[model samples]
Target: MPFLQDPPRLTNAYLADPLLRELVARALPGALGEVEPELEHLGELAAGRLFAQQAVERLLEPRIEHWDAWGRRVDHIELTPLWREAATLAARHGLVATAYERRHGPASRVHQLALVHVLEPSLDVYACPLAMTDGAARALLDAGNAALVERALPRLTSREPARMWTSGQWMTERIGGSDVSLTETVARRDGDDWRLFGTKWFSSATTAEMALALARPEGAPAGSRGLALFYLETRNEDGTTNGVLVNRLKDKLGTRKLPTAELTLDGARAVPVAGLSGGVRAIAPMLTVTRTWNAVAAVAGMQRALALARDYARRRAAFGAPLAEKPLHADTLAGLEAEREGAFLLAFRAAALLGASEAGVASDAEQLALRAVTPLAKLTTGKQAVAIASEALECFGGAGYVEDTGLPRLLRDAQVLPIWEGTTNVLALDVLRALAGEGVGEALAAEVNAHLAAARDPALRPAIEAARAALARAEAWLAAAAGPAREAGARRLALTLGRTLELALLAAHAQWCLDHGRGPRALAAARRLARHGIDLVAEEPGAEELELLTGPSADGGAR
Candidate 1:
């Protein structure tokens, strides 16, 4: 045989990740014994059979069957073999039910998200529907509508494959993307029920059993306040479309396996989630839940990419020696690994806070910290995922770019993390809005300091000081800036806070590892991340200078 390089193979997602194992063990010492078996099993499936199946299977996108032979319109979507199988696996694994089961109490969220981290990357974004399903379940429970809660909550949280249900969040329309205040979808009273009439421009998971949407009531006031959140089944009792017209499936850049559609709702029957108004406020719970999923999924993607790249480095030889033996190559992988560790801790911390809040075990300061950390984690990890994935691709040389090797999908899928749920700019503004609440800034500072206080290692002192200094600079900038200046620097300020917190959390974990005789790997990670720099705030440019740089020039020529 010719001298050919052996391809990389995954042994076990759960076993391969020491960071995940240690974090869970430290955070949920009491629950690790309970959740370990399931986590280990899912990790095997994700790396073994699922990985092999995806490698050999023909890549297929979802297709719609518009009409039958008799001219009867049937908007049926056929999913790929993996997607269909994913639904069953996800249900049996209790990927969405684990949090609601509360078997581990407040730590249940950590357990649930831990399973999601291992399983999502292998399922080809099947996490899309599961995220919405988890969000809808939380939103419905919070709404407290007796009938809908009774009818939907069980199926949504069910572990049985046959009984489990997924939901679509149909909020985007022709008029608005993130700004739901301009919604034009209208609702008309139909006795006790309501009928919705409008177009949803971007509806993901359209094949879902049901959906939560927003629409303006007839003669109601304008803007988001006029809108009401409503729940509707996608199909009627006869298994026909419930006045919903699936116009067409989107030709997306990534996540092609997912069924995203542009929909026209012609009087689709719906019931109010809470009441006829305040839909924007009512959907807050759903946003918080889904945004956390986004952050977790982002970190998971980064992990997958780095794992493959690291394995490849160990296997491939260049210039008569393995790439892993080369100092520069090893250094590159270390940088990527450090970024991944920071991202993983930041995202999991959000999950921990959420679980504590829901279990009613969190203190007042913790509750306020959760409000700010949710958006920070989402935006920060989302950006990190794209950057890490792109760099990981370069580590593979030419093989990474080849589609047949299945490496390119890592970058393509990661590109969606920053765009979905909410874009970077939009989420940065959300962070500012969170700070507007009473004691939110102080609470966030308290949370960061708590993490920094955990470190006792002398070697980790520099990283701790760097984190504290970066946080102080961010606070000072916020106090000095006002109006347009504050808004203009929102992204830098948000990133500064987010990265500062990540460094602090990593320092604490590194200290834990040192105390437990787990060696200096985590301490090395904290040091590297500090060297990468946490502070992102910069001096704001003058209005005229900014306008000149961004706007059209007076000569109407290219700047």
Candidate 2:
């Protein structure tokens, strides 16, 4: 086998698949062709792992000599050829290529939840680089920041234990993790010399050298706007203390090993990222990429959970027959499949948005859509994946609850996803603004109309009609909505309207492309996904009303 860390610097082969080709052609034309190679690499990694059960059985290296509480030796998983290749190449390229894909491609649902329900908004810790804790935040982002990120990315692809690329997101305080606005950490400016001070509770200052810290600038506002981002690189030449202190680590329900560090900054000097007022907004963008990955990870965990349930159902007999033969069990499997597929399509569409931004050609409408959808992607996907895993575990009956079965870890991992990035409530708020303001409503309606028009499958005709009706419902809602009342009404309408429309659009995209024959595997998968996606959206079915109704006096929408 090749000594590489991941698939070769190749485009994803699936993009060439019939279904994916079709989807790409419809969703993105030239752009679709461009992602082919990258997607192929993703496919290779997935296929290789799927082919070698051992590759996936243990996601991390088990070679290290350690023991769980039960004395179970930590298992060291051998790196797959593709994984190795990816890692090695990432090191050479000074960046982790498709690190997001690595986690998301396999477990999209779980990844979605982490960012949506927990990670993004929770001051419980972990800061997005886009937040207010980096110096020269904008300057660094141009080239230097990208370099550091790229340089550290490959280490993550390797089988090493500690996560790489995630430098520091300081959120502890002498008071408490909550109410960060009361944080006392200070960044004193002395003759161009910036030094950090004050003790932070659960600072985690000891874990990694680099940190995006929030510090008070002597006399400043009392709220969050008074913060700044400092790039505190690990300066300890010998991998030792670097003018920072880690008081202790906290034991938590799920992410126990991830290290909840308590820290102390002792007159530590750091590079200033940007103006103090811009910290929150600056670092907020960083969550954009990572949150997406969290959502992807959630999906991975769910898939693992499903695989476990599927395996058990096929092998274990409950009443003189395999559980798979039972109707209820069969229905459960179908539901899981439906949920998993839906999560995949949603997450993939979000990824496409990221791809567009990277290409430096994203439109205003698309960007706004991305902003709205990313959170939705995180929240909905996370909740679904976690719920699916629970169902799968339930399918296993008694055996699933056992820690030794490994099924439990998937659930635990999934549990952390929604709580990692931004909470569902926060997402709900963000989406409300997106749909109510900006060109989101009109753009979304037009997109929906187009989506319905693209479908060739007669099976979806009724659903398409219903979806149009729903769009009409949404359109009517938007037509009459205004002021604070609009926002309140927009929230509920936004979710179903956005999701239903995007799903239909994505379906039509896949349908048109597959029939036309463009990209291959990616398009083929898109088509498969489109059919399923349309079906899923059809579940909520919408149809345009002939006369159209108005007002916020209706069920969760404009009356």
Candidate 3:
């Protein structure tokens, strides 16, 4: 037999993750004793059967069949085998149901999102539809529509595979991407319902059973103020298209197996969710839920990338020794590990806060902290996911760039994290919006200080001081900068605050580990992240200088 490079294999996701275990134990206490079995089983599935299946399965994309032999408009979408299997797995595991079930009280969300974190990376972006489904459930529940809630909530949270249903979020249009205020979709009153008529430029999870869409009603004003949230079933009782036309399945760079499509609503029957206006306001609950999912997904992607790279380091040989034995290779992997640790803590903190809020156990400080941290976690982890994935790919040399090796997909899929729920810039501005609320910035600072206070280890003092200093600098910048300057430096400020919080949380968790005899690995992570630069805030360039750098050239030539 010739010498062939060994491919990386995942160990049990739950068993291999000391950080998750420790955090769960600390945060959830006795709940881990009950959830451990389920986590262990999901971890096995992720590492074993699903992982093996993914390795051998041929890459396939969803196809839309517009017509049959009779030339009737069928508009049927055929999904990949893995995706079909993923739906059943998702339901049977109670991935979404667990959160709403509140089996662990305020910690149920922690358990549910933990399952998602473990299984999502192996499921080929099945989390996309799940995120929307979770969001739709939250939105419907918050809308206080008794009829709609009764009809959909049970099915959305059902554990039975056959009964469970997924929903789409149809908000994007050609004219409006993030700014739903510019939505062009229109709704007209029918006999007892409304009919949506417009195009949805980018509709992910097109195969979902239902969707929450935004449309301006007839004789209504323009902008998001006049828009109403509507719920529509994708098909009628006879399993026929519900006046929704699927134009084409998108050919994407990654998540190719997931069906994203261009859709046209030609008189799709719908019922108003709340009222005939404030659709944008109504969808806020949904965005909060989905954005948390986005952050967790980002962290999961980073974990998967790091897992593969680390495994390969032990298996692959260079200079007559395993790559893991090389100091430089070890250092590179260590840096990535630190990033993953920081990202994990930050994302999971958001999940924990959400759980508490939903369970009505959150204090005033936690409520305000949740508002600020949600956007921070999403934007921060989104960027880290891409950076870590890129670096992890490089660890594999040329193999990382080869599609057949299944390494390039890590980077491609990670690219969507920062772009999906919101782009980095959009989320940065959102952080500013959260800060605009009274007491939000103070609440966030207090939360950071609370975490930092838990660390008594002298070895972790430097990281703790760094986090505090970065946070102080960010507050100073915010206090001094005026409108345009603040907006211009929003991204830097958001990143600084996010990274500062991550370092603080990491230090606190590392302290817990040290006290519990779990070793100094987490402390090392905190130190490394502190060294990675927690303070990103800088002086905003003046208007004239900024224009000169970013605006069109004097002669109108491309700069």
- TM, every model: 0.98, 0.67, 0.98
lDDT of 3 by residue, 308-410 (tens): 9999999999999999999999999999999899999999999999999999999999999999899999999999999999999999999998889988999
Residue-level lDDT tens digits of model 1 in 1-559: 8757778878799989999899789877987777788889989999999888777763778999999889999988999889999999989989999999998889889999999999998998999899999999999998999999999999999999999999999999998999999998999998987999999999988999999999999999998889999999999999989989999999987888889999999999999999999998878899899999999999999999998888888999999899999999999999989989999999999999999999999999999999999999999999999999999999989888889988888898899899888999999999998898899999999999999999988999999999999999998998888989889999999999999999999999999999998889999999999999989895557888778778867556945
lDDT of 2 by residue, 457-511 (tens): 6655654665666667666665765666554444455456545654565456546
- Which parts of model 1 have CA positions greater than 4 angstroms off? 1-3, 554-559
User: What's the CA RMSD for each of the models?
Assistant: 1.4, 10.8, 1.5
lDDT of each: 0.92, 0.52, 0.92
Q: lDDT value for candidate 2? A: 0.52
Model 3 RMSD vs true structure: 1.5
Candidate ordering by lDDT (highest first): 3, 1, 2
